[model samples]
Target: MTLVLKAMALTCLVLLLLQNAPGVGAQMYPDFKLQQPQSSVVVIKGDTLTLNCTLSGSGPVGAVKWVKGSGSDNQTVYEQKGSFPRVMRAVSAPSNDFTIRISNVSLEDAGTYYCVKFRKGIVDDVVFRKGGGTEVSVHARPSVPVVSGPSHRAVPGQSVPFTCSAKEFSPRDIKVKWLKNSTLVRAEPPHITPELSNSSYRMSSTVQVKLSEDDVRSELTCKVQHRTLAAPLRKTYALHQALRVPPSVSVVAAPSGAVEVNKTVNFTCRVQGFYPGAVTVSWLENGTVMNAGSSTQPTETSRGLFELNDTVTVQAGEEKSGSRFTCLVVHEDQEPISGTGILRVTAPALGENNEGLIGDSSDILLSSPGLWLGLLLDKALLAVILFFLFKRILP
Candidate 1:
């Protein structure tokens, strides 16, 4: 019995040695070979992707399958018995070619793919061979950027927010920038989000801008950069659309000092340094609104501000003396601003008696001072002559 046991042990050791030998193990499956021709591939999003897997020599192959990833994280891609909606065999059945085509490929499809061969076993399938992995890189171009600004219009020195956004892109790394009038502007870091359904990415960037009068013609641009883009994408927003500048108003009379009765005088209303050009100007005589006036269109200045001139003619009548002419300017739905000028009227010259009343009242008072002094001297001289005559007669 001991000798029989020894012989059995020797037989088992010899079998183990043969199994462990390299050439001997290779001889068991010398004719089996699985090949994956492609080393790597890149596919754009929403397009089709093809992975080639061909078998040259086969021995005890029971099934062929494609898998993504490795070990614990691996997931089956293509299997003979399973149904995959977006996956299909590239070639017809009854062939050694195992190439597959994936339709509507997305970022989630990007990974290492492997072609594997399984051998039928008593209870479970055994991995027979595996091909070198084919690394798949999916690339998708970002959508055109959209820019938005604050809802309410901004005045000078007011800070407002602007946002830029792009969506449905791949390869998470992206760059965004803000520019004002072709010059770079500092902004906050972009926010990136992932799409769970399509495995895509979305990004948004924001910037705060302080408005100025110079921004009337300025442009704000949002620029995006990505590896898939040949050139950076740009979207511009006109700064004038978000800016408001109140107008500076003033009223000036043509005959500044005073005018003769019945003389025609002009009062000009000047509206300057306003943005967006549109404005309403009206004149007021005393406290009542005037209907007669000529207003010019608002014209842009070299500095990008706007200016307008409105003129009204009035006769310097006796009843209209000391009347106040006011210019009321309304801009951008804001409260009206006003500037005023006073009208002074004088009677016409009527010989020497009305010579003092021909000009302004202040000027008449200044010119009559010398005449008053002369009259006082004449009276004194007459009194002195009479006194001397009386003294000689009394003596």
Candidate 2:
């Protein structure tokens, strides 16, 4: 009976202790959440970044810290109560609101960031919770792609070379392409270069093409794609009818036969073998320029080249003999080219069937000084002989 009574006493005490024991439940830490959902944030190298974090739940906030990177590389960049040289903290209106401002971001700042909260636990030493992470991306925009070479103007059956380049872009992945009349073209591999500091990369590419006559109306373009660009950057160049061969000048004199003195003569300068036909013809007499008469418009030849003619008329005279006449051709394709001819002015000679015929002496004597003297001496001798004959007949 005593044993039974002891057992009932022990059961009563055990029941009382069980009623006073605390209930088992999951451990709780301070409620932490990111005001802005974790997302990609792109900014220039010199721009500022702002990250906001919010706290909830009923508990005294032990501490707040911002961590950067992942795995073993994780590093605490900013602490609420700790001093960070680069982070600028703004005064929070509400005590639960935390804002972190970072100025002068660089390549090293590009990574994921997290806002972590630490709280002291009742039984456990300490507990922590992390808000959503913000992915930070710092970038440098590349300079506008430059397209050069291939000649602004080119001729058919020629090999044209071109280059496209972009400098100082962050993140080495960049797309460069070539197009002719909006059609894709196969080009050589791009040449990528890292900056001396190794923080930025530059890219360049080249292409060579054999042009055809049909390509004269086509347009070529270089297109570039990058992360910082909203649209692809493009540079366009064209190849049209252009000069291929140098200009050639030739001088011709009218009346292919013997030259006459004090008569009208025509000098023609013909320029040929040049394309894009912007040319000027000049006539030079004894190294001095003279006014020209007529110039024909440039006309295309069978070879797709240009040819033009200019004429100047002058009266042949004695002084013109042995004088140098030059036909100068000035063209866009090359320096001025010239052709020269010497003027040969001669007096008319006596005809085989001379029936007192002067044989165009009127035009001849005007320029020949020696011929005038000879004619005067002949007339004086004839008068003297006629006087002698008349005196003899009278005797």
Worst window of 10 by summed lDDT in candidate 2:
23-32
lDDT of 1 by residue, 1-395 (tens): 99999999999888756654545534778887788989999999889999999887756647999999999799999988889999999988878899999999888889999999876654576667789999999989899999999998999999999999999888899999999987899998899999677867999999999999888989999999999888999999999989999999988889888999999999999999998889988888888989968999899899889999999999999999999999999898899999998999998776835554466766765667887788789999999999999999995
Output the TM-score of candidate 2.
Answer: 0.56
Per-model TM-score on C-alpha atoms: 0.71, 0.56
Q: Please list the residue runs of candidate 1 whose C-alpha ends up more than 4 Å from where it truly belongs after superposition.
A: 1-29, 37-42, 59-63, 67-85, 88-95, 118-128, 135-139, 193-198, 351-395
- Candidate topping lDDT: 1
**Residue-level lDDT tens digits of model 2 in 38-96:** 57788777778887776666543457777896566889888766678889656554566
lDDT of each: 0.89, 0.74
